[model samples]
Target: MDTKDNHSLPSDDTTRLADTNSPTTANPAETTGSTTDPASTTSPTYTGITEEFNTEDIQVVQVGSVLKNRFVLEEMLGRGGMGVVYKAQDMRKVEAMDRDPYIAVKVLSKDFQANPDSFIALQRETKKAQQLAHPNIVTVYDFDRDGPNVFMTMELLQGEPLDHLIRRIRPSALPAQEALSIIEQMSRALAYAHSENIVHSDFKPGNVFLTSKNVVKVVDFGIARAAKDSDRVVEDATIFDPGSLGALTPTYASCEMLEYGTPDPRDDVYGLAVVAYELLAGSHPFSRKPATYARDLGMKAERPKEISKEVWQAISHGLEFERDKRTINATQFLQEMSGPRSGRDSRFPSWAYPVTAAAGLLMAVALVTLMFFGNGDGQPEIVLEETSSLAEEQRTRIEDLLEVAEVHGLVGRYIEPSGSSAYDAYQQVLALHENNKQAWEGLHSLGDQMVVAIQKLLDDGKQDQAEILIARGLEKLPQHEGLQALRESF
Candidate 1:
């Protein structure tokens, strides 16, 4: 949103190709391999070019060049700003096991090799990515070097960047469900990374790989900074700095990130929102030049008339320019996009209400009669005894409900409207003993507790759990305005 000298690069047709392994204008033949010790190496080799190359000189990798005496370079995959990506075979596996094992190897450019600090930073962050194990994220296997050439091995994804797909469907928004499916997977990946204290400072469609098998794999996890670091000097850069590389695409970066160079979990959330907005609206949210804040654009994203209001609301919230006002994390964003539950059309039939009312009146009369006359043994002892037995049964039922309510409070589970929860148990208690003060108080307390629990679950992106709690709360306390409001908010 904000324009700053620190912006990674200006938004252009080439910005999408700036990521690691992304197709770039750099010629593949310009890349050359150098070696670094695997054990002492400390940085990323983002730009594949080395100092050995003059402005007009180009060195091409041989087809059979071996890396670390393990991976054999096969062919160049694609070149990007950082380096040239090559399809390499795991020679150990291929020779020992007689099996073909191909991996994507990104050879650092020479400029990165010349800058030790930037190289070490890239190496450190790439190594950090090794700790993440998620199906939706491209896997980084190892970081090593051949001569002075720095390279990292990772899973070779067979798919196209999401940007290609978006372009193919230009002038038409992707189906809502299809877009949601992709966003959900990305959100899950981000949630996991955030849990590990890793932020994908740079997120865009180009970094999202949609496999032929319908799998979504987010690539270039920590590579954004690697690319940025190789090109610029970061005065006080940390491992987690979004601007550590001094390169952030303004189109996807948050206003605060651009203006202050502070990176947070919210920055990634903002990027995800922009990508999702493009998927749904088939265009950027704003048409004017980039501003310090998205709000400065003074425009709202054009909502696709075909999308449901719930979905549009969720997208709009994610696109908030204010960091604090935006969705706090990926989990919250996912929950909002999930939409509200399609709960039962009706809690009970109209006929059942009338029948229940009639039954209640009959029970009330019977209870009154038993209380007044059941204790007299001389006046129809048999009727008195029968009334006494019924009273005992009612008392036992109330006791059971009370016990269940206590258990439900202890362990939070099956918390649906019709499910077994403290709220439902208390409702049952009140049904039998309308004036039971303990039951009424328990119901009220449970209501309060549920409100907090439901909100938390919603924040954590556990929509199903939140829905269950809300449904059960409403079922138990149909007259609860708080519960009703919670449901409507979804």
Candidate 2:
């Protein structure tokens, strides 16, 4: 059977004396408190320095009461640019004909709320999004302002974001086959938006949400734009213009999309192509350095064959430098994607070699299921012999979990217990097979953990102790993700 809490806790040697009132979930919560309020009048920085733990810092805003009886804000789900996303109950028409009563409340930043210029951009885009209705799209229920606060109420989705999925299935580079599936849905989403004349300016993986059923939905229409000019923020010459929304993701933006001009719907296709290429290549097609820094650069798209030739044609077409030369739309690319020569073949020819190689890259993961618990070392209690059938079953289970971890890691949740455990499981496999790529990947997941741990220690006024423990861990594994990040700071 698969064990849930088989790993032991940290030894007493490493334990810090945590206070009873110390915050459990939100570490350094102050640092992330006012993510959008640009005005200096906002609350003090929750930098985890002076205030270790306080109830005021984490006050829950009453949704219905605060925003003029529109919706009652409950627990916070997550935070992002513009405002925080909260689980809210809609009291808009509760006394009328009966209806399901909850919705997502997206609160805008105070500074932006005060700025008529910025606030109007949010208002225009949300109004346009409210007009859209699709099963694959997150429905915008209504838009309203509460006194000085602005918020958009919409359907609350209950699954991980596509960004989450990408993190879970992080490939050093993705298989062309897998990459094709992601791009297909993304194309459909873009096509739907284009038909509605609403451009999803930010079309990165983070915008996609995935349900338990593998159903995908494109979300976050906060910065979406209309076919014509609703350039409210641009009038003020703001540092960022949400209404003149074009590609915000530099990693995936096309050359045309990046230049100074109004973006067309085709820009979305170009961005999608870049995403598809990254999924297969396990890296961005464009270099971070400016074109001037690298003299040999050209207008051609990076060859998919660099990762998988089978995907090269789709990549090349999607990333064509000239808008007219590029694939006309997502539908055209979808057709090409369905063909036999695409990355769908069971056995690829030499041209398909690279992506095929990625498929076989096993991340050996071992499940150490022992009979003891309460030990501080955190080592697996159970260690079956290498040849036993029970050991094989455990190994299989761990491998499956590792696959999920790989996907989740890429999506940005790799440091969670589930994510790190997958890495721990792979390390056990590495004990048996030294050069396993998956094992190394599991090791890579530790980067986030080490950083979090170090930050906590610093916040607790134990900088010297934090450095010492971090140094010891790094000396043992030089390439470990956690240590590499720390090294960069020094």
Candidate 3:
């Protein structure tokens, strides 16, 4: 079923799948018109669009309608060709029982429901998606049929689709850091799904949801194909299941998908690359036409000046037409973009260097002694060493703790003070060495930095942001004087 528009569908006896024959638009977000605004009288409209389903033929569920005596439909979030998505409250579960009492319901349209084959295909595909449980992927709770209506309950998210975000911030792409952050989360999600042998055939911006908390979630895995059954086809009478109707955005479809009607992990990698390219350059990699294996009919994407060389190279590699030549997988793409992690560098505070250096020197001396002064038994002559082995071990432990503490301090300084990096690191150091003044000082310093950040937020009249920062800081460092003072101020 073509549930392309992110909407809920109603039940009907028609055989046609929802939105399957709808005209494709240049903009992916245009597939589904802007969601209905409950507060506004005017409905959102899109240009160059033709919906296949006739609104007059289907019975639209009204607001406040209760489904299965459990989900109370509240507002229409979006509508796609195959379904309508609604923000509903789970009356059976209280807020205390369920952290999120609100849920998203994707109800199939009447036309889609009328086609038994399409309904079965959707059910089978959604069942497969249930196996994918990860922090970066939207959580699919349950799928059920209430009388004529078929719907799936998923985590209700407050965020804009990536396509909408791109459209809203066009001409200027997302900041480099923000784009990378989103990509990192997306890669992890794809990697996890790939590990489970699931390949998202339709990985595109429209399917990526970025939450208010800056978390990137990959949705619509319901149409994903299993890697082990690459050639498997769904024989739905109503739809041509070119690997689940090959329901993919043409702009992001990989060469394999276009050429052979098959997809693998590389297809997803290619899609992610296209997304990264668009985010960095504020345009598609191919300007004139969508990319195809048989022809390179468009201008090649030029590297954005704002993006770093390493990141651009990674993105370019991922955009390769040949599957074998593309970035091998999502994990590799992320590694290339993020670069390799090495030992702590100059960013580490000055005081941290002395402890690290001393620890290294001690280890070096110990190693040299072991090599040159081996006893007859082949073990190092501990008795002849300048310092006791126990002393050396203690120094090494202290060094390790200090290194961790330094890393935490740096993370807190640069990323976010509310993060447990500095606080947890300091606590570990104190546990090992109670007299470690640096750890204590670092903890207090982090608290002080957090207070400064909160104050700045308040000064800028971002009271909500400041309160969130203060709450996070206090949660981590309840005893910190600066955090305590900041809490009082709030």
Candidate 4:
């Protein structure tokens, strides 16, 4: 759970879902007094939003409505989405006397409940999304229903959406370096999802959020997007499309998505590029036109003078009208832009360093030789310190750290709980002794455990979850044959 909570709460084992607000789930009462206007002047001017979802018969949910005696709908969070999002109060948490009982809930219309299978599909995707623990992705908690209304709950974030930011910064580009940072964060989130065979078919500025802390979080993972799984029969029964919920933003949607073609990572790559361009130029590449329309009209985006040739080329590649000619995925897009930065750097790998952190060059060189001195009961102990560089105190510290690492490994705390997991403990050892064979081997062993765990997901027919774990493992052990093999097998 790589969370930066709205109440300044710390991230825990499970990232609590929270956010300031997006235009669709727009206007948290704490921030503004304005009611939702889909035709709001600030929103992107895209016309492809046909009333395909037929929301005119939209069910009205009052602010004070209570559902199933569990959650109390308190405020209308926003109205620009396929459904209404609310800042709700959890009766269970309130009953428990919990300090933070408020949660963000997105309530789907009657169409969702019309076909129970669609609810099942949404639940399955929500489950897959909960495992996406990256800092830059929104954390979904669970999905449930209250009579005919279906809703999903997540952490309550207190910040502005990326679309708002882009609107606020219009007429001028975001500083080159600053835009790079935003692009990298977006890519990291997309890359993590792509690794799990998941594609955010609908990627747009509205879905991208920027917390008050200035951290980027891409929202709406699986709620109302086209499924890429060829075997899935979730959407076959309903002609009632999720796109009516505004899942697919035509301006940001790729040519393939607009044509109802096969889903691919390149679709997201194209969307990412559109958002990235907006960050740089503060405007849509094709003036808010859908990909197919823009391509047919022979419209080409003019590179902003502020961006460099290298960066513009990367952004342009993603804007290609054809999937084959477009950027392959977010990873390649990030690399093409300006390479990895800080926590998301691929060079450090998530196995040795935590995926949510950049624990780079922190390993100490541990050159250990254990021997028994005088009071020996047959247990090997560190007793020799050959030089000042290998001080007795340093040796003792290394031994203590190694012991801690070994203990964490045995209990299966490989790369969690942040700084205290086996990976972190082992990293601490290496920071003290870079040449420590025990620490390196320990990291590899942890990688092996990850492989075994992912295999279990695959065996259980949880391919999406398994792929996500494999991506995380490869980050730490890119060269680990087992992890690599799992990736190629996918």
CA displacement after TM-score superposition, residue 368 of candidate 4 (Å): 13
Candidate 1 lDDT (Cα, 0 to 1):
0.60
377-397 in candidate 3: lDDT tens per residue? 776543322112336555545
Residue 294 accuracy (lDDT) in model 4? 95
1 or 2, greater by TM-score: 1
Give the runs in model 2 whose Cα sits over 4 Å from its true position: 1-66, 92-100, 173-178, 222-236, 239-247, 287-296, 299-310, 339-490
- The models' CA-based lDDT, in order, is 0.60, 0.49, 0.60, 0.64
Model 3 CA deviation exceeding 4 Å by range:
1-62, 94-100, 110-112, 224-238, 241-246, 341-490
Write the candidate numbers in order of decreasing TM-score. 3, 4, 1, 2
**Cα lDDT for residue 482, model 2?**
45
Candidate 2 lDDT tens digits, 1-490: 0111112211211111111222112100111111111111222221232233232344335433546655777656554434566666666556554486766776754435544555566677778787655545677777777665567777765656554444445556655444544565566566667777777765665567654434456776545342123342343322233311221444444455344346676667777776776677665556432212222366344564445454577667777666788777665665454434543553212222232221222211211111334134786554233322336554554454454344333322333332133344455566655545445545543444445556667779998967875785575446454455566675
Q: On residues 292-375, what C-alpha lDDT tens digit does candidate 1 reach at each position?
A: 544675766677777667667777777778888888888777666652323424332221222234334444544455446663
